[model samples]
Target: MDGLLLEILTAVGFGVLGAVLFSAIGLVSGTDETATIAPVTLLVVMLGAPPAAILTFWMAAAVSKHMTHAVPTALLGIPGDTLAIPLLQQATAMRNLGAPHIALRKMLAGAVISAFIAVPVAVLFAVILAPFGSYITAAAPWIFLIAAVLIAYFSAGRWSAVAGLVPFTLVIVALQAFTGTQDVKLAVSYFLGIAIGPLVAELFSAASPMEARRMNRSEYREMTLAPDVKGWGGYFPNPFRVLDRFQTRATAIAAAISSATFVFSPVAVTVIAGEAVGARVKHAYHRLTSVLAVRNGVTESTYIAEALIPLIAFGLPLSPVAAGPAAPLFNAPPRFTVDAASGEVNNLHNLLSVPEFLLYGLLAVALASLIAYPFAMNYARQAAVFVSRKISHEAIIGTFVGLVLVIGLWEGGLLAVFVILTVGLVGGLLYRVLGMNTGVQFMGYYAAVLSVPALMRLLT
Candidate 1:
């Protein structure tokens, strides 16, 4: 009993830490989840934190970030992250209408409600799917291939992305083979390279004479701070009261449905959920607000579901979120791994049972609700102003670059560093030229590692 109490307390401590840390990170615009969350979570895993603590930390961080990400989206008219992109249209519309605060509130409210709904629903789905875990693991290679093609086809690049996968996967296979010749194995390098691809591409473009004019900014980017209006008396207002009956219903329904669609891309599900809900509303203002609520709601729901379902059911990085931001949880090398040849696994899936997942999952959500939700609700305008004026985007990008360099060198010295550079440069360019996003790139990585070996064996 004492040991169990200590474990629970430790999980709570980690959950709080994740919530506080990511809440601040969320306020910084353009902080991609894959770049920020994956590395940090990997560090936690590698440090030998308990499995329950790791799960809680990740859940709290993801939930908290989704809540506060609305700050920049609604107030500054810039997306807070990739997932926050789906909320931009409605957010910008609301900003232009002089009701950005209301938009922010609606988004935050939707996120809180949706997160609570998504946890149990996603776990239930995972439970149902758990019986097929063995079958899924056996067919993991083919499933990853099909999922890769489907995800690519649904991406912004569509057919172009699908075609791009072939060469992208080939590049990874080629890199692995080259690295193998040197008796070195690389995984985190590939993930980091892909995660920061766009940043690398932009840096290279900045140095090119041909792109000098386009890269140059004439003046400082101007941003207007939206006025804060407190409608309620307390620090944390009821999310239910913040949203209308219809908006609450829409958010709940969207969240529940999106939780089950964990196999799909989170951004895609978010867009579809908002569109599905928005089409039903007649009033323009109501439609915009409802869509904002549903979209933000889906962001929380899809992220939780994508990460949890795959982790709980198949112990594989099957979903895009699992393959990208949550990749470390599934396969962080010697600490956590998904063996390609045997489909053998040793990770959070085996460490934490279903009941523990449920308990820690809800605990993380509750912690985020207590910390990030109210903090964003009460101090959004101030947070937005500080982030805009005080924060240096370049510094953030450089920090991540330095972190990647340290990790790459630590992993396999110069060989790994070069592999990271090679993958980053090529993947970054492909992302910039084609509409092939990081999600597609991640799927391509999976295909290279999982599907390629399976194919070779079948052919032999």
Candidate 2:
């Protein structure tokens, strides 16, 4: 086999391994990207793994975590994290019907199928578009502006969205001015300081005797499978049955488009796109879950595609998530190199060298789905029984919060712990006061970054 083929096979194997390990972790402790996969990516990058290998591992880990997150959301009525929050209602309804296994199976199947279908298409687009990378890079400022405007408009109605632009622009200018100092460490520390500002406020509040209760309490229903379907076979939720009821090509296309466009924040795109698609289709509530499943699949695929396309074609980090994993592919300071003769930017980590990473990543998703399906199916009945007999809904929330705290500490040290608390409080306040989701906050931050050039132009 050629090197590419060998790399593909190796990546697939790694993905399968990641699937089993992450599935077990998700089953016991439901956590999302930050806690479950980000740490691993950071570690692998620190260890000096090849960019292709690191990307392969990142894809495998992501697919594994997402595939298994469905279990808790379906069986326990407890979403793994923010990403799974949108599916909570549908999962609860399925679990109440003793079809938790079937729900999980459908979700896993959808993820696997979509990953397989979407990855290659995305890779092809990235490769074919590689020649035009310079033009794309040159347009980055405009793209960011467009993205920010779109996010603002979609997040709030037209008037409120327009109102939000002022603060967003101000924040970006402030951040850029502070970080543009000549001293590197000082600049980095300043950037980190800005990142942790919310955390500081939270710690002061938490230190007070008045402990803010952040726990969510919901009723847990014990799932009982129909007597006829009791084993591994239960894992294969009749996609045909589900599709017969909810499949609309228009919905799928909408979801896919939303996923493709919103590369910076896939989960937000999935939720908004799912809602839009659901409204357009009949049986909005019933179809919402599947709409989200398709959205989730498409978003993950788009994320990989958009991030990789920019990196391989132009050597630019389009999103924070992409930046984290792709950092190793280029040497420490990733840069764009233009060919003098043709003025074409060449990303050393182009599809010619990196296609195998995506191929293997999809293979891992397939393997994970296959293995996890049977186990999840069998466990669904047991999980229902166990929860009925032993677990309390409140206890699960407590455990999840504890896990989040530990993960926060791991990611940002004491600083991260503080930041999470701040983010939660501020995030909650933003929701309560401004009626904004975390997505809006993210948009504000990115928009802030793009505001620098506009400010500079005005000053000049």
Candidate 3:
């Protein structure tokens, strides 16, 4: 009983920490989950955090980030993160209509409600899928290959991304082989490189003489601030009250459905869920608000489901969210790992039971609701104003890059740092040029790690 009580306290403490920290990070625009969350969680794991605390921390952070991310999306017309991108159109429309506050409230409300829905629904799905864990693990290589191709096809690049996968996978393979010759094995460097690829690519473009004119900005960018109108009386507004009955129903349905489709890209699921919900409403205003609610709700549900379902069921980094932001939870080596050759695993799946997953997952959501939800609800405008005017994008990028470099150096010294740079520059260019996004590239990394070995064995 004493042990259990301490466990609960630790989980709660970490949950609140994740919530408060990420809530602030979410206020700053363009903080990608993979780049920020993964490294921090990796540090937590490295520091020997209890499994329950780790789970709660990750869950709370993701939920809180999505909730507060709406501040930038709705108020400043800037996406707060990768998942926030899908919510931009409706948010921008709302801002133009002088109702950015409505958009912000609806997004926060939808996220809170959908997070609650997603936890139980995702766990249920995971329970149903758990029985197949061994079979799935046994066929991991082929599954990764197939999943990689499918995800590439589904990416914005379409056939181009699919074709791009071959070279991308080969580059990873070549890098690994070269590193193997020097007795250096690297994983996090590759992940970090891929996560920060876009930034690296942008910096490279800025330095190029040919792109000088395009990269140069003669004047400061201008933005119009929308007036805030408080719709509710208290610090905590009822999510259901913020959204009407039809909207609540649509968000719930979308959250449930997107939770089931956990293996798909979260962004893709978010966009599709919004389109499906938006198409049903007749009035343009109603459609826009409903879509905003559903899309933002999905931003929460999809991340929760994608991270939880794969972690709970198969213990593999199977989903895009799992492979990206949630990677450390599944495969932070020396602490957590999924062995490619033997299909052996030791990570969250072994540490936390299904019941623990559901319990801690809900706890994390509740913590986020109590902390990030209300904070964003009450201070969206202030947060947006501070982020847009005070925060420097370069500082954020440099901070993350420095953090990644430290980790890379810690893991494999100078070799790992170079590997990160190589992969980042190449992957970033591919992502910017061909629309082969991070999700597909992550799958390609898995293919290099899992499928290539299997194919080689078969050939031998």
Top lDDT prediction, candidate number? 3
Pairs that collide in candidate 2 are: 172-448
Which is better, 2 or 3, measured by lDDT? 3
- The lDDT values for all models are 0.91, 0.51, 0.91
Give stretches of model 2 more than 4 Å off. 1-21, 28-30, 34-36, 127-132, 156-205, 208-231, 234-354, 370-375, 380-454
Pairing residues by index, what is the TM-score of model 1? 0.97
Writing each residue's lDDT as its tens digit, candidate 3 over 188-300 gives 88988898888888888988999899789888888777887766779899999999999999999999999999888899899899988888899999999999999999999
How far residue 102's Cα lies from its native spot in candidate 1, in Å, is 0.7
Candidate 1 residue-wise lDDT at 107: 97
The model with the greater lDDT, 1 or 2, is 1
Question: What clash pairs does model 1 have?
Answer: none
Clashes of 3: 0
Tens digits of per-residue lDDT for model 2, 1-460:
6976766666665556666766665554234444345444545545555445556666666665666666667766777555577667766776666666556655655555555555565566666767886686676555556655665555534446546656645744553454345222111122222233333344445566665554232655444333224434445554434343444343345434543452455656666766766676676345655664665555455545545555555555454344332322322212223222232343435433555545554565566656654556556546444544676646754654664456555444554454455445544444334544434544454345443454456589
TM-score of each: 0.97, 0.66, 0.97
At residue 43, candidate 1 shows an lDDT of: 85
- Deviating ranges (above 4 Å) for candidate 3: none
